[model samples]
Target: MTVEVFALGGYGEAGGRNMTAVRVDEEIVIFDCGMSLDKILIFEKDFQKATTRELRKVNAIPDDSPLKPHRSKVVAAVLSHGHLDHIGAASKILFRYQCNIFGTDFTVELVKSDLKGEERYRSETEDIKISMYAVEPGDEVQISSKLRLEFIPISHSIPGTVLPVLHTPYGAIVYACDFKFDDHQLLGYKPDYKRLKELGKEGVLLLIPESLRVKEEMKTPSEAVAREMVKDTLQFAEEESEGIIVTTFSSHIERIQTIADTAERLGRNVMLVGRSMGKYARIAEELGLLNLPPGSRVYDKPETVARGLHRANKEKEDWLLIVTGHQGEPGAVLPRIADDELPYKLTENDSIVFSSSTIPSPLNKAQMYSLDTKLRMKGVKMFKDVHVSGHAGREDHRLLLRMLQPEYILPAHGDADMLSAYAEFASQEGYEINKDVFVTFEGTKVTIPL
Candidate 1:
């Protein structure tokens, strides 16, 4: 038996570009189909000049033939989680291959929301049928004669991120992407330590782990810290202020839930704005993962939200406005409001809270500084960094390494420097440079023969 792995997208860097395939005998199993942040910012620069078709080509599969050859033999597209960096390309690639998609319940809902608009676009162009298999953590799905997949729940900012354990003929390969070890998780149950130790005892042959936070020395903080920050900022605001705006990542369902809870405590009528925010919230609530208060509203239409904010500003003392553009993305609702593009205006004591850290990208930094200047000019009270990362840090990575004890370690989902740091850590644990530890880039394939 022989198993071959290919990094179709996310290898050297992070964001929109991520595609990985494992070929075992005649069957092909895909891990993720997503785009990179690099690709999105490039396309955004010349929005009017570039079409979706063109952007798709820039991030297309390296060679369509390898995927097409065994397209019929493809058993499943197993998603590690619901993050766009992991599942965003489903709308573009689902039509190309005929396979069942397996993911956690919340991950499936999040994917459905992402593809909703794309489905309409595809329907206008061609006939497509996308079926989603929603499985919970610990549920096992046999894809082919030699492949068994299971989802092991992990603590992340999102509700249903999983560490995929693929039981192949040669050995089990665990794909650990985009996860953190939060012993003090605020919303859901804690990480399944017993299951993880059980898998560790079973003996993993290959461990593909995320290296996004490997450079950081400390373990990522828990979601509870973010809740405290939110509480402090909200309490600091004027007692009679009407507008209280908070912005964060749209996929952060836990943070959104916490925000909603805080709003209820503060006697505020919660309002969720932004296209993606409303879509994800509704899906999360439908799955019974999120429960909004009786009268909370979610609005996607900008004009309607503007009018509602105007009315709420006049009468309500506690009106929570949850929005997008936490990184100051141009034209996002928060930036638009800061620029006075919205009908409502920020008063002296109105609060604007950023429940997120500025991603370290240059473009994000510049846009955030520009937005801060604008909001400052309007005398808006801005609170920042009321958030914690969802990625495991250096100490978390060390713990995972000690638990798994895989034969081979491959650092993934990070740039060369970050991956290199991870590789160095493995060396300290006595892993050989090339024989036991492998660092690769996109288009590179690693093979194990049996």
Candidate 2:
């Protein structure tokens, strides 16, 4: 049997447009069709209204032309998690493949929600109907005669993240994209170390792991530590702050819960404001993944958000405002508020806490700088980087390598420097460059001998 791996996108980029495909004897399975947020921001294009051609032209979405010839051999597309960097381009690209989509429960729900916004776009073309299945962690499904897929629970910033393993005739191929060894996560499932050891013992032919943060010297801190940081930050805001506004990733339900629960303890009502805040939090609550305190509310509609902000302005001490735009993206809640487009006004006595780290990209850096300048001009107290990362760091990656001793290693989910760094680390672990440890770019394919 011949086993080949395709790096369609996200090979030389950091958390942007992640897509990979594996082929075993003419049958193929694709993983992660994501989009680049930096490209979207730099081009200022509406993601929903942008056509596939336009997105590809701007380098926003994965250019799948490399797979056009083998599209017929594709049997399934599997999503790792609900993050946009992992599953954002589903509505725009997955229609080209004649296959079912598979993801964990929350990941599937988030995708279905995103598809609703593409109703008009879908109607403009041939029927863009696709089947999606929700599988729980530890569940295995037969994809074809020679391929079986399994979902191994893993911890990350978002819920429903997993390490997808494809069992083939040669050996098992593990896709370890965007995960951390988080044991004390406040909300999501913990990493299944036992299962990973089992896979390592069973013999893994190839291991594809995310390279982001692999250069950091220490293990990534647990979400529970972040919970403490948030709690301490918000608790200190209770005495003197008139308005407390915390901004973070809308998809980070655990951080949201931490902020909400802390606000409740401070005798404040939680007000989640933003289109994405409502979309992710509401679904998480409905699915029993989040338990928001009673009397806490989500405001996404223009009218409702205006009313909510107006109310907060009147009684700023009574509300804890959770907003989007942690990366300072234009039109998101926190950025709009900094620009005075929202109803609530910032004051010298107010505090704005950022529970998210700035995503390391040029567009994001400039936008965040502008937003911080605006907020600083208003004299609001700003708190930054009050959180931890969700990707495995150097030591964590070392642990993963020790656990899964695969014959071949492909470092992904990072830029050129980061991938090279991972390759160097692998070399320290006795793997050779361009041989056992392969560094690939987007649109390139690596063939592993069976």
Candidate 3:
């Protein structure tokens, strides 16, 4: 038996995230097709100059020359999770390929929401039509006569993230992407160690793992810490303040639920802002996973949010404002608020809670600092670091290495330094670097023979 793998998207490259195409005999499976916001910004500013057509090409999958002939024989396009860096470009890549797309319920919902938004941005031919198969943890999806796919639940920041196991003719290949072993997760469930152990017993020939947190020496913090941070911040905030603003990742539905519950407990009316946040919330609500309070509102238009904020401030001291722009993206709601672009002005006593960690990208750090400084100048009370990461750190990666014990290890989903760190850790464990352990780059293919 022979197996081939391609780093179609993500690799040593820091940003434009893509990965994992496996070809075994007649079956071809694509793992992920995600984009890098940092790369997109660069492409816009330098390459495309904000041209939509050029931006689409920059964001799209490379020419089908890599997988074209095998398109008819493709079995599935399996997604690891809901994060844009993992599944965001699916609509662009899979539009031409005919295959069943597989993900968890929440992941599918998120994709649907994104597809709806993409319709407005993309050409009619480039528009997405998602043919999805929703599989929960422990459920196996048969791709072809010789291959079966299983979803093993893993604890990440988002719900329904999984470690995929592909049973091929030679042996099982485990694709673990964007996950951490957070035993103290607040929503959904924990990583299924028992299932992982069972898969290990069955034999894992190759393990493709994410190296997002390889530079961090310790285990990633649990979501519980983030929850407590939110609780404490709200508990200590001035109760007499007329408006309360909380900004975080829009796709973090569990965190959104937590914030909503906190608002309810504080007797505050909830208003969700930003187009992306409102879109995801609507999809989450439609899926029955998120049924916010009857009075909870979502506003995509800035004028509507401004009016609502004004009325809420005048009407009540307790009003919860959930918004976007946690990373201080220019023109996003939070940055606009700080820049006084919003119709309503931020008052001295008002609170702005940043329930997110600034991604270490230089652009993000600079923008966040600028936004924070401006907010401080306004005398706005600020709460920061009310969040936790979803990626596994060095300790978690070590634990996974011990548990899986595959013949080969491929470090993925990070920049050169982070991937090098992960490779170094594997070397310390006596794994052969670039032999039994391989470090790959985007567009490179590795073939394993049995």
Candidate 4:
């Protein structure tokens, strides 16, 4: 048997837009069709109305043209999580192959929601419908006679994230993108250590792991730690400020829950604002993954958001506003607030807490600098990086390497420097660069024989 890997996107960049195609003999499977948020922000195009070609022109989505010849061989599209960077391009792509889509429950629901929005915007002549299956952890799906897929539960910034395993005649290929080995997450499954060790014993032929934080030289902190950070920051800000506004990844339901609960403890009601923020939070609440406190409100529509902001403005000390645009993307809720385009106004000593870090992309860095400058000029108190990361660090990578002793390694999901860092770290672990440890970029294909 022979195996070939096509790094469609996200192999050479830090911020997402990740797509990869794996072929086991004649059959193939794809993983994580994500989008580049930095590109999307820079272009400021409405994704629902934008065509696939337009998105490709701006590098917002992965260029899947490399799969043209092998399109017929593609059997399935598996999503690791529901993050837009992981599943954002679902409607833009996934129609050509018309293959079955597989993800965990939350991921599947999020994709369905995206497809519904796409359908609303498209003409009747367009056909965007595709079959999607929600698979749970430990469920193994036989894609074809030659290929099988398995889901192993893991923790991340978002809920329902998994390590997708592709089993073939050669061995199992483990996709370990965007995962943290944390056991103290309050709202998600703990890492399935026993199963990972078993997979190690069963023999992993190739391991494709995310290399974003491999250079940190420490284990990633648990979500529980982030909870404490949020609680501590909110409690301190409550005593010093009259208004509190917080921003984070909308998909990070755990962090949102922490913030909401902390706000309640501080005698402030929670008001979740913005479209994406309300969408992800409501979905998680519907799926029983999140139980929002009673009387807490989510405002997505423009009219509702205006009304909510007006109420918060009247009683600034009594309400805590959770919003989008933690990266300072233009037109997002927080930035609009800074620009005075919204009903609410920022004043001296008002708390603006960022429960997220800058994404480390050039566009993100610049936008954040501008946002910080604007907030500081308004004399607001800003609490930055009041959060921990969801990605694994150097020590966590070491533990994963020891648990799943794969014969081959492909460092993915980062820029050139990040990928090279992973390769160097692997060398210290006794793997040879250019031998078993491979570093590849977008559109590059590598083949291995078994």
Candidate 5:
């Protein structure tokens, strides 16, 4: 038995789309279908007008041209998590192959919401259809007589992230994308290392791990550290400032949970004011994962936000306001408030804690600085980078390699430079490049040799 591996997308950049495929003889499974936000921004206003081929040309979506030849042979499309860069392109692209979609509960809802937003796109593809299946951490998906899939729960910024493992007659293929090994994760269960080692003992033929932060020298901090950071900042602002406004990833329910618990302890009311926060909050609530205190307010609509802020302003109430726009997106809630479009007013000594990191692009940096200027002009106090990354750093990557002990190594979700660092690390661990360690990019395909 043999398996062919394809680096469909997410090869040469950061904050880009991540898609991978593994084919065992006649059956195939695609790992993820994310889109490049930078590429998509050029055609953002009229996404429906942009053809799939056009998106591919700009590298907005995965270069799925490689899979077109075996389109009908696709057995399933699986997403590792609900992050936009992991599941963004699935609703638009996977349906073209008429395959079943698999994800965790939150991720399934994310795909459904994406599809619902693309009504015109779905309408045009009248003959194409897809089904979404919700699979838990330990659930196994049987693709064909020769292939089986298992989702192993892993900790990330989001609540329902998983590491996918494919079991085939040839061997087990592990897709460890966008994860941090947090034994004390605040959101979900710890990394299933026992199960991972068990599968390793059964012989993992090919291991494709995300190398986004492999250059960092140590193991990544636990999510609990971020929670403490948030708590400390909120406590400080409660005593030292007039009001507190914080921003973080909307999908970070664990952070949100920490914020809510800490705000309650500090005797401040919690108000969530962002469309994305509302969407993810509702998704987590439905899955019984959100544990917000009763009476915590969520304002999704612009009018509702303005009204709530107006009331807070009128009462001179000191509340903890959680918002989106950590990257300073143009139309996000934080920018609107900074522009005075919202009813909220910034005043002296009011703290703004940034619990997120910028993607380090010129465009993102420019926007963030613009927002910073606006807030500073109003005398708003600022706190930044009070966060921990969700990717495996160099030490964690080394440990994972030791635990899995696969025959070959393939690094995904990073550019050539990052992959080069990872390749060197693999060599130090005794795997020779091009023979046991494969460093590939988008559109490159490899046939696994044992």
Candidate 6:
């Protein structure tokens, strides 16, 4: 008997996408049906207009062609988190496969929201149904008798991210990516070190960890640090002036919570400024993952936000604006405000804080620079990079290797440089390259030795 692993997507680069699969005998279990953004933005900005075949060609969506030979054996597809790179292509490609989709409650809601929104726009396409099941962390997910799966609680930028451990005859194949070992978290439980140690004792054949920040020498900072930073920035801004706007990733529920608390303490009424920010916050609150301050206002509709902005002008310090588009996406609230499409006014003495770092990309850099120029012309003061990454850095990576102590290691979620660095690091840590450590490219399969 042989258990095989497929590096369908996300193995070559970061931002989580495509498909990763495992095969045991005849049954197949897939993890992360994700999408990439480069080709989509470069070729076709509109997804509904682009055919799935074209999407596959541009690498916008994971090509499941590799799995077609064994498609009938596909038992299930589970998402590790709710990031777009992990779940964006689901509505586009999930219907092609017959298996059901599995995720945590928050992740399930995010996927359902995507499907529901896409259904409204895809009338020309054939009708398809998506089957989804919500599974919590610590739940045993049995795909087939040969491949048993379990969700180990983990922390990341978003809520509900987990480590997937697959049980087989040889040992367990632990899929650990897009995660951090955060014992001090604000919105979610700490990483389940207890369960991870248990997996170590049980024996792990191979370990796949996110290698995005493996070269960084420091461990990722705690969410609590960002919270304090938010509090300090808002307090300082309030003392100088009352008109302050904060932008961050919409999926970061913990960051949103910190913003809400800071606003409450400053006696400023919190007002959500974008549709996505509102939608994600509502989902988190509905799932009992967040508790927005009571009487906080949300203006998801453009017209409603315009009116709210007009009202906030009456006493700018009395209103705290939490918006989407920290990266300065054109459609985001900040860009619209800068472009004068929104009724909001950004004047001198107003504070604009970015609680996110500019993801390294030429497109992002250009867009952020444009936004920064516009705000600068208005003489607005800006604070940026007020946040920390959610990925595990070098120290944490070393700690994880020590904890799991797998016989083999696989590096993922990074580009060639990052992956190469990981291979060398793994070698230094004792795994021999090509033998114990595999720098797997997409479509490469690793067969467990019999």
Q: Indicate which candidate wins on lDDT.
A: 2
TM-score per candidate, chains pooled: 0.92, 0.98, 0.92, 0.98, 0.95, 0.95
- The total number of steric clashes, by the backbone 3 Å criterion, in model 6 comes to 1
Arranged by lDDT, best first = 2, 4, 5, 6, 3, 1
Looking at model 1, the pairs that clash are 9-19, 10-18, 15-35, 15-36, 15-37, 16-35, 16-36, 16-37, 17-35, 17-36
Model 4 agreement with the true structure over 14-88: per-residue lDDT tens digits: 877999899988888999999988888877668988888899999999999999999899999999998888888
- For model 3, residues 259-291, the per-residue Cα lDDT tens digits are 888888888878898877887787777776666
Across residues 287-398, which tens digit of lDDT does each residue of candidate 1 receive?
Answer: 8888888678887776677876666667557578899888888767888888877766788778888899887767788988999999999887777888889889988888
TM-score between candidate 4 and the true structure? 0.98
CA shift of 253, model 6, Å = 0.6
Candidate 6 structure quality by residue, lDDT tens digits, 18-129: 5778887788878788888555556645675566788888787877788888888988888888888888888888777888888889999998887777776676557686
Tens-place lDDT digits, model 5, residues 344-394: 788986788999998766678888999999999999889999899989999
lDDT of 5 at 176: 87
Off by over 4 Å in 2: none
Tens digits of per-residue lDDT, candidate 2, 131-153, equal: 99999999999988888999999
Q: Which stretches of candidate 1 lie over 4 Å from their true place?
A: 41-53, 60-66, 123-127, 238-242
Prediction RMSDs, each to the true structure: 2.6, 1.0, 2.8, 1.1, 1.9, 1.9
Kindly give the stretch of ten consecutive residues in candidate 1 with the minimal lDDT sum. 43-52
- Higher-lDDT candidate of 1 and 6: 6
Give the Å shift of residue 239 in candidate 5: 1.1
In angstroms, the error of model 1 at 243 is 2.8
Q: What's the CA error at residue 181 for candidate 5, in Å?
A: 1.0
